[model samples]
Structure formats: structure tokens, C-alpha cells
Target: MPKFIVSLQSNADYEAAKQDIEKQGGSIVDDSMKILGMITVQMSDQSASSLKSLNSGIISVEPDQEVTIQVA
Candidate 1:
């Protein structure tokens, strides 16, 4: 199966979002953050439903930012 790299850029609450991601059935393959409030996340591919849910959750946060999702 193909893979996807979901990157969420925000100064939002990563902890809560991270937890939600797992609960939604996606795994965090890698993640890192910088002091300037930039976060990069790489999550494992999950079911379409799960992926949609995860995206919805992230958008719900309404971070003082936006999310960029890319497939690989």
C-alpha cells in the first residue's frame, strides 16, 4: 500500500492532538518541533475513515496556523 506524510504546522496543543491521532488509529512515525512554534509530523497511513477523522480533529483545533498533508 502507498504511504502518506501528514504534516500539521501549528503552535496548537500537540500533546492532545498526538493522543487523538493514536486514538483515531494512525501511528506517529516521526515528529519534531522547533522553538518558533513549528511542528512537523509524519503519521502512518490508516483507513480512509480514520484519516478523515484525524484531519477533522486537527482542523477542529483551529490552530493559529494550518496543516499541510502530502502523500508519498
Candidate 2:
């Protein structure tokens, strides 16, 4: 299985993104956020469609704050 590291801005983003990713067979291995408004999550997936969809809505997704997700 492949792994992905997705970063989200807020709790809502994390939750929504988590749900979406889970639908694509992503297993969240870990997650963390900082006071400066940064969230890091480790996930695993075999497809990219879910991530692509999630990213497409990121701008209007309304996370807690300005955040960045680095998919690894």
C-alpha cells in the first residue's frame, strides 16, 4: 500500500478530509496540528482520485485557518 501525508488547516478540514480519504481506502496513521495553524496527517491509499477531489475543494472548504497540506 502507498502512504500519503496530507496537511489540513483546521479541525473541520481534518475531519472532512479524513472522511473523504477514508472512502478511497486511506488509513490515517497519524495526525498533528500546530498553534500557527498547520496540520500534518499520515495516510495510506492506492488511488489518487480522493485526494484530487479534496484538494479541488480546499479553497472553498473553509478550514479553521490558512493551512497547507503536503502530500507525500
Candidate 3:
């Protein structure tokens, strides 16, 4: 399963979004970012695509990536 970052719209229902993700066979990986309206989930690519399209509260479903910073 691939990991993705799901972003919700402001004022969107968090619980509803969580339920929707579960319905799509996705599991919440990290919800610590929920305060920022973002959640990390682990699921298939198809599930991510479906969730993004079917959920109105979802702003985006993007693959999770690592960011690195270099000190100059």
C-alpha cells in the first residue's frame, strides 16, 4: 500500500473524512497534523484516487514524500 497525505477543506468534518477513508479501505497513519486539516493514510493508489473524487471535503490526496534540508 502506498502512503498519502489527505488534505481537508477548512470547516470540513474530520470524522466524516475519517469514515470516508475507512470506507475506501484506507487506514489513518498519522492524524497529528489534523489541526492543520491534513492526515496521513496508507492505502492503494486506487483507493486514494477514489477518496479524492468521492469525498467533497477532500482538498487533495497526494503521495507522501520525504523532504530534506541541507545546511549551507
C-alpha lDDT of all candidate models, in order: 0.45, 0.47, 0.92
**Comparing 1 and 3 on lDDT, the stronger one:** 3
Q: Supply the TM-score for candidate 3.
A: 0.90
Candidate order (TM-score):
3, 2, 1
lDDT of 3 at 25: 96
- Candidate 3 local lDDT, 1-72, one digit each (tens): 899999999999998999899888999999999899999999999989988687459999999999899999
TM-score of each: 0.42, 0.47, 0.90
Report lDDT (Cα) of residue 13, candidate 3. 96
RMSD of each: 8.7, 9.0, 1.4
- By lDDT, rank the candidates, best first: 3, 2, 1
What would the per-residue lDDT of candidate 2 be over residues 1-72, giving only the tens digit for each residue? 544445444544556666776676656555554333333333343354346556523322122335689999
Candidate closest to the true structure, highest lDDT: 3
Scored by TM-score, the top model is 3
Q: Lowest lDDT 10-mer window, candidate 2?
A: 56-65
For residues 1-72, write the lDDT of model 1, one tens digit per residue: 233344344645666666666665545554554333333333444442354455333442211235789999
